[model samples]
Target chain A: MAALNIEQIALDIASPLAEEPGALLPILHALQEHFAYIPTEVVPGVAQLLNLSRAEVHGVISFYDWFQAEPSGASTLYICRAESCQAMGSAAVEAAAKQHLGIDYHQTSDDGRITLQPIYCLGNCACSPAVMLDEKLYSRVSAESLVAMLDNLPERES
Target chain B: MSVRVYVPSDSTALSLGADDIARGLGEIDLDIEIIRNGSRGLCWLEPLLEIDSPEGRLGFANVTAKELSTLFSDGVPGSAHPRCLGLTEELPYLKQQRRLTSARIGLMKPCSLDDYRAQGGFTGLTKALEMSCEEIVACVTDSGLRGRGGAAFPTGIKWQTVLSAEGDKKYIVCNADEGDSGTYVDRLIMECDPYTLIEGIIIASLAVNADEGYIYCRAEYPLALERLQQAIELATDAGYLKHFKLQVRKAAGAYICGEETSLLESLEGKRGQVRFRPPLPAIEGLFGKPTVVNNVISLASIPGILAGGAASYQAYGSGRSRGTLTVQLAGNIKRGGLVEVPFGLSLRQLLEDFGGGTASGRPIKAVQAGGPLGAYIPPALFDTPLDYEAFKAIGAMVGHGGLVVFDDSADLGQMARFAMEFCAVESCGKCTPCRIGSVRGVEVIDRIHQGEQVEENRILLRDLCQTMIDGSLCALGGMAPFPVLSVMEHFPDEL
Candidate 1:
């Protein structure tokens, strides 16, 4: 993928949402959806469009864990590490995940194939030990199944 | 007559490969009409395939793509297959319970407004349109409906405050940020029966006379967000939403944002920090205007109260907790799924009878009620009635009605440490007790577990928890101690 100018894309995203009340979050969402992270160069443009200070825009970005300042890896897998999953031995599953990928939570793989992150819950508590890859949620996820999935992932971001 | 088969598109069912089963069924040469419906909340029974048999809706559990071909080789509902679960309702896990808020979930096609109507969906809103705002509020108040989002505050009183509050720009906000570890009814309702929620929201708008409403759903639930957006459009195009303008707001990752005030802040595009209470949201909220903030269950229960009237809905349950509680059985349980029952059922019944014991075939040791913040009820207290007041008396909460069962293998000390760790990670960092105390808590538990200054650390942990209980701004800090204290009190040896 070609790296487009962040300013133009930010303007296009922020301009339309600027008129709406509480448009900052929506604009942030759109930007993240487009670029997979909020580019630092577009902060000023977002601030200007929303009639806010650069500090305010940056604060919002930094406050939300979902808003990444840096680009993510090829694929992201959010493993549930909350109370429910813990009861069903997510600790073991998490350990397996770390061992298999050789990466901790919030860390991307050396090959840039995956980024492991901790999610509180996926509401699939019945199945327990849930994991979300992109938009789809998988329940009762064993380390074996997860490894099989990791093995099939693309090598790097295009 | 044409044969119809129902399969759940609920994320839980999907995760268990319901899509593959559905696709395999479609590829078969049989003349079957497949309808993707919402989960019946019987999650352990997913991919719970149902076919409209002449007798009833015959059900099957754990049906795989390969099983789909063999199971349906005869091309009918009850073909004497090993997977057949007889009538769906006859299954004890699904039957022997009350379903009020989710009455129409698995029975109808999720996005079909027509199917929603056929199942008595818009009756509540229609009734609300006929009655005065005071009348609607009176009905809800009399029904004894409380917020199912852990707090258990009366829903009618909140709505009444919003109604009487003098704000020209009053708003109704649905707290769909279901961050609780074992809770998913809100997402289920929004995904399966979106119209019911839409109808309920419309009723709330009519009752409060608020022209605008927002459903602040978490970003984790993409399908729910998509379905609600579609439902809003459909309801609008159908003229059911003419009275109110409803929009869905996607919330970024923050467990604290599930708190009403924190949710308001996040909705306004700010950091999700809990606001100090004086002017409650009912009096002054949401852009400095009076707002009615309610859980998805609270709002969804409105239509039922409106349609059935207060007295009928009030008949279920015991003590102060009225109406049916949508108890989610999760974690290491065997038949884990959604079970909506009256408030007075025993935890033993839920855990043993409906849940069908542990998945690992080990004896059950502990069960965490009411999400991550709830207490760990020991086996000795399993016989306790599942009531808010009853659980409260025992130092537990029915928080969001999520019960995560743990087998004997679980380490109670590790669980205690995890509660603090979760609080440390998710704390908004606005207050001292929650922000600083949580980190200290993890260290204290670690010391206790390591037998380093065990007695002294135990005393220190008790005092620290008390300080957090009294000084913290919200439940995140206040109730984080519940699990730790309970495990310490009930299962002292483990800790």
Candidate 2:
């Protein structure tokens, strides 16, 4: 993995805010948008700019599940494990995805193409089984469809 | 020539292939402007189509890709065929609703700033910027709007407490961790009309004299989290959230943190655990200063109360439960979605009229109003008004306005055990009644199921429930018994 260019990213983020006390969220958003995660090194820079402690900045970043410190895979696949989705056979779909992608929940693939995550509910209960690939939600997802979808994705190592 | 096309992003609509319809429409080579809006609350005929008209947005009950071509050629969006609830304005399910919090939901394009402004989005903040903190508190107080996050404490009282406190750096935290089963109203409101929630939070911060705010949403709602983040950006750029320094914080899938104190603890990057309440969140919350901790529904409802004044909101409902409740209808229902209705509507009316009964084509044996903590009411008690006091009279709560129905096939004993087990798993373990009592309750229910001294176990379970209710520190332990006890008492045959 390439070392995160924290100073460059922080500089990029700092230029937009102009030292606003309330720039923490925007800075965090900007960092996450650019790198898909907040690097640990940027904590002090964020703290200094926002007039907050390093721990305070870290606390706010870690509190939100969407904010990650580590670099994420190119794509994320969220499989629904809520009761409604479970009732329809998400377990089998999950198994198929895990087998096909070669990654467990919260783990990125070896090639770094995808990260598998288990979400409790997608609010697509009526459709029974659901899986969200990035921002797009696919309902009534079967094991076959799951495999097909994974196969269709662009290979990261290539 | 502009064409208005509406595609509902409501869960029920999505479940019924609205996404496919939207994708198909996007692919079509037609000069049509698509507006992906929230549900109209007419869940029965979902994927409901509508077009811009001189009268208003003309409604069609349900339309597929095939029907869309014909409807467009006709130049008239006709009535909902076969299942037309007629005009959305006339439907009792929608007509009777106060719609304060959900006023902009289906009326405006969700992500469009122009639509939000046209539908009175940030009017409250604009009005509130002129008022003093005390006057803002007084306005909320006069409105009689209580916290819709299950506690039913007056919103005005909570804000007044924060306003009166001394602090240079206060925080306003909006608890969007709606962990309750069969409840997606918060998610709906967040996804469909994100500005309302942002506006509410901004207004709330201004009222409480807080400079910063955080919206603690659960990880389960990724779509809601994404939309809220996007909305925050939009709000910031447009100077709504920027004026108050508010940001939406996402939770790491903790159900217990739906409680205010627990939510505060989680915001500080600690485990989502409940804290004791003598200090009270209003006095010392969110990094040990004054904080205004509110639920998504509670915060979102503030803008309307401020805009319409308290009297206009107060005049809608009965007793202390003034204003409206954004009731979420889910589970085994033919029609399931978010419906913002006035407090006076009866359970029977909501279930039969809005919900259209069980989706399984069977009789609804039981209905669990509120979240899992709420009691399992029998069909005989369907006529009971859904007001907070009325629900309390029947040993129930309108908790977060989640109403889940179950068909005749449901097993009451199993359902009772599930509730106890749920409480056991989700308990913060701060107090004993919830920690140990839930385990014992589960054991006793299991004993009954096994017919091992069934009658004695039933008595034992009842006694345990009473002890837990009286001895528990918070609602987690206290309300856990409601579902178990209510099912045993009301649905003896099912058990």
Candidate 3:
């Protein structure tokens, strides 16, 4: 199949949802899901298609922490920094992860394999200091356990 | 008889590795059918494997993948495997309380319509189907059921406003944006019993004369969102729901959106900044139409209230606080999980009897009742009951019924600072007091901690907190001072 254009992809994903009230958020979500993150290149096109100003679209994208402006790396690592995790010493877990991955929150590794982010709560408070590496949720993660989990992540498909 | 086994598929259970155990069971050559059910709220014992016997559900605690075959070979139910936790219902922690809103969690499949209907699933909706909107509203009002999402406002009163309000189109929105650190009750209901929520929303739509509804769940809870979306689709497909239209809208990581107005703003695909009151969401809510925005727990509890009469549901609790509360114990607690009890039960009982005290084996120095915005209660005041009025009487609100415990190892200064920092990070920038007071609050606490003008800083912190309390536009700014003040009152040395 010929490669689909990014503008076409944005239009194809957003057209059906544009009619819904407050359709921008849903459209952004669909675009992010297909592209792994919102593409800045499609911002102007999305604005034109949705009848929103480019600034308004950008403001919405920037307001929510989930809507990253660039394409994601191979995977994203989320470390819980809320009170429950702090009680169980998430600082240590976070430290170990940063040391292991050689990256901090919002920073991709030098080779671009992983992007780290700080999530407030994943509702896994029962298992304090929870971290979601890729799609898996690991509980009661000590520094050592988090490192092991991070290391176990499979290589990203090129 | 073919033996059946259940493994929880909730986030906590999955985090503790339930899927691997199920896969391990799947590999075994046995007639036993494996069912992926929601957590029984016995979180500490997950992945708690349950077997169906002639008696009831027998449980096994923390079963690993390797132990699956051995557990079955040792004769699962009657045989005394070391991992056996006995009949799950009889377990002292689960048996000592009520499970009104959470009755169906852990017992059945998370999204199975057949299982849901078989286990009295739409009974309340079926009953509600025959009632008038006025009668439905009256039943909720009589139930004395308040919102479980921190605010403790009367659910019936909020609905009454929307029901009576003159608007072109009314909407029912479920605030599933449960971002509080210690609370997961909303996520539990959505994940464990999605049908309950679906039924509850439909009933709400019926009572309010709303033909459209939305469940604005946080993107934080992917599993809950996925299940709720699937449940809505399933309910729609099965013709269990028709008159009302329902949809699950995903919230993009905004903690302030948990506030109903901010949530409405976010739902409109705008910045999740707080909107002013008087023209409450009930009057001019989503898209400026009359809307009823209820928390996940408050709405989810409706089906049971309707099916079992308001008084029967109101039989629990004392004073103004009626009905059972689903208290989620987090932080350093040993028996960390969800406990549904009456409102009058004290934090002492929940912390000791249900939670089994701190996991670190140290005496719990403090407990943050409610969420980040809630006050920190020292051990001296452990006897304070879980009533909304009772908590407020002692300068704390039972906000969302989440008690996050902290042992002796915790640094109150850091905890205090973090509370301010959390407010600062999530303040939505709508008002000045929260947006600026929080950052200054953190600096003042730091100065006090560093022994620089300690006395002056303490005074300044107190002054700032009072300003945030009195002047802020929304609760995010208004209630953020509770934790700061609690730290100052109880742990003077730290501040």
Summarize candidate 1's per-residue lDDT along B100-172 as a digit string, tens digits: 9988889988999899989998888878889999999999999999998889999999999999999879899
lDDT of 3 by residue, B67-106 (tens): 6666777555453656667889999989997988999998
In the range B1-495, model 2's lDDT, one tens digit per residue, is 767778888655765678777877777666678888877766556787766655556666666766655555544344544433455666666776667798878777677788888987778888899999999999999888888888999999999999999988889999898877667778778878888998888888888889888988876676778788887887678776555777777676556788888888777655556888889989999889999988888989988888888888889887788888988776667777668888888999888988888777899888888777888888999999989999999999998887878777777677788788878877877799999999999999888888899888888999999999999988889899998989888976544
Note the residue pairs that clash in candidate 3.
B150-B400
Candidate of highest DockQ: 1
Looking at model 1, the pairs that clash are B370-B399
Decide which is better by DockQ, 2 or 3: 3
Least well predicted 10-residue stretch by lDDT in candidate 2 chain B: B76-85
Number of colliding residue pairs in each model: 1, 1, 1
Error of 2 at B289 (Å): 0.7
The number of clashing residue pairs in model 3 is: 1
Candidate 1 lDDT over A1-158, as tens digits, reads: 22347788789878888887788999999999998889999999889887889999999898888898988877888999987888788888888889998889999888777788899998889898898997889888887888887777755643
Which stretch of 10 consecutive residues in model 2 chain A shows the poorest summed lDDT?
A81-90
* Residue B49 Cα positional deviation in candidate 2, in Å, after optimal superposition: 2.4
lDDT of 2 at B62: 62
- Model 1 collision count: 1
| Poorest 10 consecutive residues by lDDT, candidate 1 chain B | B72-81
* Interface RMSD for each predicted structure: 0.8, 4.6, 0.8
